[model samples]
Target: MKAKTHAEEAAAFIKDDARTHWHDETLWHVRSNRDRSAQGIPEWETLRDTASATKNYVLSHLGELLEQFEANAKANGVEVLWARDDKEHNEHVYRILQENKVSNIVKSKSILTEECGLNHYLEKKGYDVVDTDLGERIIQFAKQTPSHIVLPAIHLKKQDIGEIFHDHIGTKKGASDPNYLTEAARQHLRKKFVEANAAITGVNFGIAETGGFVVCTNEGNADMGTHLADVHIACMGIEKLIPRAADLGVFLRLLARSATGQSITNYSSHFHRPAKGKKLYIILVDNGRTAQLGREDFKNSLKCIRCGACMNTCPIYRRSGGHSYNYTVPGPIGSILSPGRDLKQYSTLPFASTLCGSCSDVCPVKINIHEQLYKWRQVITENTNVDKSKQLSMKVAGMTFGKPVLYDLAGKMARTALKITPKSLVYSSLNVWGKHRDLPEVPKESFKEWFKKNRKQ
Candidate 1:
């Protein structure tokens, strides 16, 4: 089956007006929480500045810090592997599993694995990987991708999840109580946690100085899976690294606050060393990150803590739904990150924004997200073959706007046509805006015309 583009998928989502409105308001509530939390902190902006600076330094000395991290992790008895891209990364994990003869694995909420398509790879290779986090597991059972990084099943309602569980895992049919479903999922995941021989997790922060990593989860799934398994593997993007242990403090404070307005995640589990007798494996993934880093305009996108604050605050993401992005990590952050991976596939993403700058203002690391989106548009327009009609329209608009007389004449002509044209013709499929939205009522005369007649004396 062919996948739909962002616009097509979004068009489908907007067809469900009730769901769209619910999604928008739900995310707005999260954004409201974030605002209240940030307002509670007097040094919030200062923390953002510090976090941004630290990431800048980390990027500047990335090679050296990576080396330092590897040495420290090895010294702490954690085996470290570097994967240059997704193929190599998946291969490395598969090789590790084969050597160890691991048949089943339990995983926490790891967006990295999702991005790399690891579960499908492992499943095809005859390994059963269970996503232990409730949200992740729900989507896993649904055979769908995560709608949001932090809230994987945000696109789904309680009734939807209840029905899914009832159909797939045998929860009571039509019982949609939050507590009941949570306990049902808990029991189900607990069994997997006990049965799985290995566990994998995604790192939120990797400290280069200490050669340690941290996985923050509200569900405690990371700790549960890691502690019970004989072998624990942590997958991380190269951008997850920080220069020092103390820098972790700066991020931890900002992360949960900006994400869901929580002061801290319920379980901020740290993996400084492999537990005694249990093996630890760390896979540091590149996966086109270095290439993105090389681009001066977008390098700062790596500063993201994956708190998903931008997605929560994004107006388009709320209305369009995460599936619209057709990406693993969907929303504003996804739009910025996805285009770098495949410009042809994601060319429409940068345009997904209203350029309202809420994402930039809400970002704890100050990534200049809106500005980057603007720059990406210019880059796309310059490098790619734009549609002939769009190109001609831009040229005409540019020419008219560049000359005052032409602009005035064009404005008058446009208003006159709008007023005279039949409603059906004026609001036909030919008008993109008219297809979904109402055009403002045309005036009988221009504002300039009224000004000259009434007040020019």
Candidate 2:
């Protein structure tokens, strides 16, 4: 409850709800939907393969494609800005608001904005930014960062939101019904939407061929907010570009099914050109993403559709929960991606997974998430400072198993020592496995010894 940073919050969630079963089941529910949806399409696997190839092609040629996208977007009347980092990104947005003298803005759910800390930056610059999405609004009022990319306030119950509303909006106490709470949010956001001069949204997909951005939403908040505002801004990662418009068909089919098990989202607004009398802008953000793309093995992560399917399907993610990942994008995807930014700080996340490939199987873009998590561990241990105790233990373990004779002798000695040791020592802090499950019974002899005796018999 006192978690100030994303990592701290994630750790708190895992420790607090150790007994909760639904955390795992909640993800599995989405995974089941994903599996069913993928099965529904006969060419789903082929489609995923194609999407991966296309994305890789685009990333490899990103420099040229970005310039082309910018030129085409400008021709279509959408101003394009390139931000090298978070500070530049924030400054550009702030300057845009100041240039128009617009004070109020409405934004749909945007993980990019969250990543850049855009809301806080704008607030400090003296702009009132209202989150139009219901879940986003809930977390905004609570002064908390979104726990999940797709569902900002997924961790909160209706009762929890009811409390937030009562405190922030003076809604009648004890009104915990979802319908009433949603309507209250709608009315409040409607006033902001009408009064706002600009709206910002996150692009789900950006078609490089035609210079258009796509926003997918179940609530239709993006459409309404953009339509009403005088200016519109679409925030996107440079990696969001697809080679062509038809390529979106492949991603669109996989996005909803992998995300929430729906055939398609309620709305898929394709903004190829700006609306009449409205100014449009696109901010292409490269916050540690370009560096991630440079890595050969980890680059495939760029193809992620931001679908929660991987988290839903991961055994560790389900048990430890999304918040345990300790980043904006939680679950399997976040664990692999978070380490790219701060290798030492978020090192524990990659190790948290059980190396299950369910995440890869469910991924729309085929990111090979489990494999990437493994690769990150080697990178972190080699290039970064690991805990002293862990380093010493690993060194001792390497020495013990470096030679076959030494390994066998050490194994026998270990079994002998285990026989005489008290259960307390076996179950003490020395054993990480014991904390989670019963200690396995040590074998009397090596498997090779047993095999030799069995062959003689």
Candidate 3:
């Protein structure tokens, strides 16, 4: 079966008017809260600058820092492993579980694992894996991948979650209260936490200087799972490292504020060493990150802190929904990153923007998201096989735009057509641009003609 493009998926999402509006408003609310929180801090911009600069330094010295981090982590009794890609990362994780002789696993929110399809891989190997994060668990029950990176189940409503819980976790048929549902989830996950043979967590920051990593979460599920399980496995991309422990202060300040408008995550648990009689493992996975770092135009995208601020502030993303992007991470940032991994599959993603620049404006780490999106579009057009209609149109547009006389004639012809053409013909299937919007009212005369006439007066 042919895969649906981003536009097709987004059209389906927009068909549900109420849900689409609610999704847009809810994300905009988060974006508004982010703005308010950022405004409260006097040095918010400074923090963003510092974080971006720090990440830039890390990218430049990534190999040296990773080595330093591994040495210090081993000194602290933590085992360090490296994986060139997703397959190796999953194998390393499975091998650890196999070596520990465990089958049941409880995991906190880990986008890296999701990117690698770790849960599916482990389940196929006969190991039971449970996602303990509330949003993650919700989506897991729904058998859907995360829509928004930070808010995994942002596409789901309280009513939708209540129904899912009733079906899976045996909640009341119509229970929709936030507190009630939260307590029910806590009770359910408590048993999983207690019985978990191993716990997996995603790393928010890995300090090269100290070899300690931080996992920030409002629910403290990562802390609970890791503390209870005998084996703690942390998965991180190579870009998660910072040069010094102090660098954490800058990122920590920017992350929570940009993500959920909190001053800080409720728990910022740091793991430098394993608890006595327990095992700690860190998997540093490359998975195309090295290639991305080598791309001069897109290396800055690696600096993303996974805050989802870009997603929140993107008007196109707000209207289209994250699932439309069909990538592990979605929205403006994903549009740029996805094409680098698989250009043919994700060629349309880069064009999924208005080039509004709001995404870059809201990014905590100051990644040039909108600019990169534009750059990716240019690259896609030059390298990929674009549609014949689009190609011909662009060629005609190029010729017309390059010649002043042809440009003026085309403008006059368009105005005349708009004045005489029926709405039905103007907004036909062929006119994709006018499908959802009305053309502006045509003026009686072209601006050039009016200017020429008035200048003589």
- On lDDT, the candidate that comes out on top is 3
* Best candidate according to TM-score: 3
Q: Is 1 or 2 the stronger prediction by lDDT? A: 1
Q: Which residue pairs in model 2 clash with each other?
A: 10-323
What's the TM-score of each model vs. the native? 0.96, 0.91, 0.97
Pairs of colliding residues, candidate 1: none
Model 3 compared with the native: what TM-score?
Answer: 0.97
The lDDT values for all models are 0.91, 0.84, 0.94
Off by over 4 Å in 2: 1-11, 399-420, 441-457
- Give the distance in Å from residue 156's predicted Cα in candidate 3 to where it truly belongs: 1.0
Candidate with more favorable, higher TM-score: 1 or 3: 3
Report the lDDT of model 1 for residue 89.
89
Model 2, global lDDT: 0.84
lDDT string, candidate 3, 82-187, tens digits: 9999999999999999999986799999999999999999989998799999999999999999999999999999999999999999999999999999999999
Off by over 4 Å in 3: 444-457
Which candidate would rank higher by TM-score, 1 or 2?
Answer: 1
